[model samples]
Target: MVSQPMPLLNGEPHVGVFIKTASHQVVEVLGAAGLAFGVIDGEHAPIDRSVLDTMLLAGYACRLPLLVRVADGSGPAISSVLDMGAAGIVVPHVDCPEYARQVVAHAKFAGGRRGLSTSPRYAGYGSMSMHEAVCSGDETAVICQIEDPEGVQNAQLIAQVEGVDALFIGPLDLAHSLGADSVREPVVREACEHIARAACGAGKAAAIFLSDPSDKAYYQELGVTLFIIGSDQSMMRQGTRALSSA
Candidate 1:
């Protein structure tokens, strides 16, 4: 069977949150909360393959499209997550067209380097034939994170790469790469706009992490259609603080 399409592929202003906790309950809760999607923070979090497997199961059980942010973004790393039935992958430090191409190559099965396997959950436990698996696997989203100045400079070309679903801006990393004090710095803001423009120009989704929901309008005007508002940890902390104050 062909896999379900990503919400981002619709080119709408979809909001999601990062899932840093390894608990399946967190995945279930986020799905219940009406978030458009969720990203498992495998990059920074201590979530290993076993933990990810359980999380993906919870996601599928709850009908939540959960993407995984890989730590290294290598071929094996990309393939492993997709094989586990992750909705997609968020590969970081995709600073150039070649690297962007590699990320797509690793995630796609047709005309790509991704190894074949019908035993994985993505293949419905051998229910899908090779052809069907290829088609369904290729539908997995391949989001490239543009975190460096070099990535911003190459955003136009990177966004044009086929099989790339979205250009995700890692705001903190981008700001750090530019030696800026904050994402609000003039230079950082300009770079973010440039990346969004490039992605929009190429008919791809432009995504970014936002600390404040109020800033959504500003980025939306710049052609950003996908917003990762905050992590589960941050939201929990905010809720706890608000409860204390009240």
Candidate 2:
């Protein structure tokens, strides 16, 4: 029988928070705050594998699903995080169906080239059989980021690619690609809506990074169910301001 997919990609409304730092404390805090998952920002953060491993362990302890947004969707990049016990991978800048396929190729082991290592943390450190490990890896989530104009244009095709569990809209980079003044520009909003429609049409999840919670209702109306709202640094700044004002 086919096993169930990971929680992150189970066609449910999930909320995630981004972690730019290597602090396990932040993961603990976010878990306490009731976020469904935590994403480690490897794309922009200077986090080394050692730090990432620690954070992953912490998240596991906290019973929170931890996904790594790798620097890129390279095979090695995706394989390393999977071996480290990440619940899934979030690939950046997938502009076409081929790129989305490549991301899955690296994230999934059935048709992909992910190296096998039953001794890794993901396999229970040699406890799990190779067959079980491979099946588990295949079920791991693969979320593709649709950031550029090309990605938005091909969003539907990308969503239809097998093993691509979700489409995440990176508004900042998308705004840059569209030559818009800000992510809130009408043009960017239109592009986001297009991508969301594509995801919904393909029976996949539509996700976004919303800096402001107030924008949630707008995107929700457009069929966006997965929301990654705010980051560790932004939360710190807000906390600092609150403390200083008190």
Candidate 3:
């Protein structure tokens, strides 16, 4: 079966949350809540392959497109997550154009070195043909994270790279990389804007992580369409704090 177009690629404003709970139930809840999407925080969370598998299954059943933030952006890591039926990947620390190209190459079956597999869940348990699998795999969004100073510098070139669906700003890491104390610092905001402009100018989606959901409108004005506002853990903390106060 051919893959459907991802919402993030539609150039429209979409808001999602990061998944740190490693629970399929959470995925189901998020989907039922009508969130546009969810990103499994494989980069910082304790989600293993088994957990990922279950979450993807739940996401599919609930109509939630769940992407993975891979700790290692290697070809094997990227392909493995895609094979398990992830909606796409959020590869971290893509600091250069060459690295961006490598990410795209590893993600695409046409111009990249992604290993083919019809046995994975993504191919519907070997029910799909090789051509169909390849077509579906190639459609998965390949988002490259711009988290460092070098990444901000090469944002334009990275955005210009073919096959890169979006440029996601990891603001916390980016602020740390730039020796800033907070993501709200003017310098950090400036860098974020520059990256957003670069991505928008190249006609790619500009994505960002925001601790405060209220900040989305600010970034939206900068041409950022993809917003990851908060994570499961953070939401739970806020809920409990509110309960305690009450």
| True-structure RMSD, every candidate | 1.1, 2.4, 1.2
Per-residue lDDT tens digits for candidate 2, residues 1-246, read 122224766666788889999888888888788788888999999899998988888887777888889999898999999888888888999999998988898888788878888888888788888899898667778899999989998999999999998899999889999999899899999999999999999999899999999999989888888899999899899989999999
lDDT of each: 0.91, 0.87, 0.90
- Provide the TM-score for each candidate, comma-separated: 0.97, 0.95, 0.97
User: lDDT tens digits, residues 137-224, model 1?
Assistant: 9889999999999999999999999988899988889899999999889989889999999999999999999998998999999989
lDDT of 3 by residue, 28-129 (tens): 999999999999999999999898889988888888888899997798899988988888999999999999899898998998999998988888888998
* TM-score of predicted structure 2: 0.95
Score residue 163 of candidate 2 by CA lDDT: 91
TM-score of 1: 0.97
| Model 2: colliding residue pairs | none
Candidate 1 vs 2: which has more lDDT: 1
Worst ten in a row by lDDT for model 3: 1-10
Off-target runs (Cα >4 Å) in candidate 3 are 1-5
Candidate 1 Cα misplacement greater than 4 A, ranges: 1-5
